[model samples]
Target: MEGGKRGDEAGPSSEKLGELSEKLNEVCHVGEDEEDEDEDHRSNGVAAGFVPGPLVSLKEQIEKDKDDDSLRRWKQKLLGCLESDSDGQMEPEVKFHSISIVSDDFGEINTPLPVDENQIGRVLFTLKEGSEYRLKLTFSVLHNIVSGLTYSNTVWKGGLQVDQSKGMLGTFAPNREPYEHTLEEETTPSGVLARGLYSARLKFEDDDKRCYMELKYSFEIKRQS
Candidate 1:
């Protein structure tokens, strides 16, 4: 009788173990499915637009069809006003000089690159709610050509994402002069509820998905006095 009772107890224990094992498998499969979905989403997002071309050395490109006068002129025109003494560069380099917020009400507020350490975590600037503004970026390309350079900005309020933007800066060749790009105009959301501090991340990347820079900053929207 004791042996039979022990077997009966063992039967329920084994059943519980089996139930736990099935639950664990289900959880693992769910996690894997979510990961796969995320991968597919990322792949589809990139494939939908702006596929980067293969990296080619600037020297090789300059050497191609050297004898063709028309092609040479065309290349020169395409690559605007390159430095006469510029050496053949193997890879591209980008240097961000500054960013400016331009608005009719506020004029312009310029922030220099590599923000000061003391200013880190501090509010960079404040904007009046409902005001329209445009962002201007000044940068320079050095060495080789930069292809499909793009900009992205994401803003969050109270740990929740509120806005996102992406803009294509286009391909650029090394030049002595800096390039200035003004983004499309945007109006700040207006409301008592919208007046608050917000955190943002700005990123610059190329067609290869190589990140040139990423900056995190905070700003505030205030009610107009």
Candidate 2:
């Protein structure tokens, strides 16, 4: 009771107690912050507000983050046909007209012509086994590829009969009227445009074993597809 009554008169000791209390409060606050920091590190592998590790400048990283493979781009193809003649000893430039595109087993419009029904000559086309595509293709052209091959003596007196297997002598022979082709002003496709391909072929009889009636084409089907 006596000490409590004198406490009011003794002010220096009270001030010391207050200073000690302030120090203790500061220490408690520091301890709590350290515990919070440790808890944050355990949960997130980093201090809540602290930035860890060295800061990296973007200039040092530069273009390294981009993929190198992204540089390639899609490209389109050109389609059409041109012909050359090789009957005689010297090769001759052939002119072609009435080009056509044919297909078989066309399951869809956007896909390539089926294997069996792929690009070939003749309106009569064959489809592959289990093929769901359409057949028969034709296109217009100004002239035949081997234009000069149908000169005077080439036609028989008995009227021209084209050997379908040999392109020139067959129905398309120049002297034959039944299968004669008329020149069209357009280089555009007229008959079949399966998917998106165009084709033209030339057949001819040759004494040279090295050459046979062959296919000539420059049709563009979407290769990117």
Candidate 3:
């Protein structure tokens, strides 16, 4: 009788486990149908399906779902962030971690500081056709206080501008590419790429007990003349 009663108690829990299992599977699905070539992609586009990459063995929570509004809302919010505009502006407090990039042979900026005007005579480079240069950034959080929207899984971006005098540069953040396979694995941003002097600035703001480290780096692009 005890065994039968235990089985009766376990039935609903087993069903709940099944539901959570399905939800987890759904979250793991990133990217889209490859046959649908209408989609444009720069990196492996398969990683967009979850909140946290390698979300640490979700196992399954059964009883919690019956009244877990917090978990449900969290799940919905995460999916919304991922599905929202990838090219749109990000919220404040989104801290950028690091910036690393390389320059072309014609390129030359190596130091964190921009090169002197006189040094421009030496640093000038171009991109090698079909070769992929990388720019990546690690980050903590990005959220719009007004809307409470948060951006996730960002990569280091390129096209940065420097004020030189003010030591300010154009905002750079994760671009939507790569990480498709690394879904939820916070990809790195690409660095300023061109045939001249360049530098990138990283900024960060913190919330939710997450500490952010913002670092900046600059690389010179050169071409062998």
Candidate 4:
């Protein structure tokens, strides 16, 4: 009779223990799934922080193309300046950095002045054909001023007028803002190009042609070279 009672008690205890084991397994499975989701979320966050290699390459390529385009346009402008004008009557208004007149062959005015009255006599002074003895006149636009405006500058050398302009700006227009002008012309001692004390009378004029802000500058014309 004791053995029968003990068997009944064992059957109830075994059933309770099996139920507890199943509950513990379910809890462990749920915890493992949650941990896997957290790990996946961390991997996704890391990927989002990094830019793709292809996208970075594309951005670099775009910048290079833009730089190339700018360089090409600049080259075109320089080539155009060296070419003759389409009308064949206008002077090529080249860009310069400073204001001075110098000879290509004899060097600058400070070297040694050319003594020949008809220096390089064989080479005639003609705008159509170039000459070895050339005058490079460089000047820049004054700051705080706009284009399409005329500035007066009367230049005298050897008591003869070299530059007498009612509108010194002429028909030339600036290629860009803060432009400088370089005038390269075949020169001779004849007319007003003879060497002497050079003087210039510069003035800015109003719309009514009234001159103001008058300035005078003088430079020696003797080049020893």
TM-score of each: 0.73, 0.17, 0.25, 0.29
Cα TM-score of candidate 1: 0.73
What's the CA RMSD of model 1 in angstroms? 22.6
Worst 10 residues of 3 by lDDT: 178-187
TM-score winner, 2 or 4: 4
The candidate with the higher lDDT, 1 or 3, is 1
**Residue-by-residue lDDT tens digits, candidate 3, 102-134:** 434233322322334554323222343333443
**Top of the candidates by TM-score:** 1
Which pairs clash (backbone N, Cα, C closer than 3 Å) in model 4? 111-224, 111-225, 112-223, 112-224, 112-225, 113-223, 113-224
Superior by TM-score: candidate 1 or candidate 2: 1
Candidate 1: residue 195 lDDT (0-100): 99
Better of 2 and 3 by TM-score: 3
Residue 211 miss distance in model 3 (angstroms): 17
What is the per-residue lDDT of model 2 for residues 80-188, given as tens digits with 9 covering 90 to 100? 1111211122222223323333343333222122223354432323233222322122222122221212111111112332111112221121111223232211222
lDDT of 3 at 21: 33
In angstroms, how far off is 151's CA in candidate 1? Answer: 1.1
Best by lDDT: 1
Q: After superposing candidate 4 on the true structure, give the runs of residues whose Cα lies further than 4 Å from its correct spot.
A: 1-98, 106-147, 157-163, 166-177, 184-188, 191-195, 204-215, 222-225
Predicted candidate 1 versus true structure: per-residue lDDT over 1-225, tens digit per residue: 122223322332343324221211111111112112232355533534656545555555555544545444545555564645346655678999998889887799999997888876568778999989898999998877777777777888999888887777777777778999998898899999899999988877776656677778998999988
Using TM-score as the measure, name the better of candidate 1 and candidate 4: 1
Which parts of model 3 are misplaced by more than 4 Å? 1-92, 102-131, 142-195, 199-218
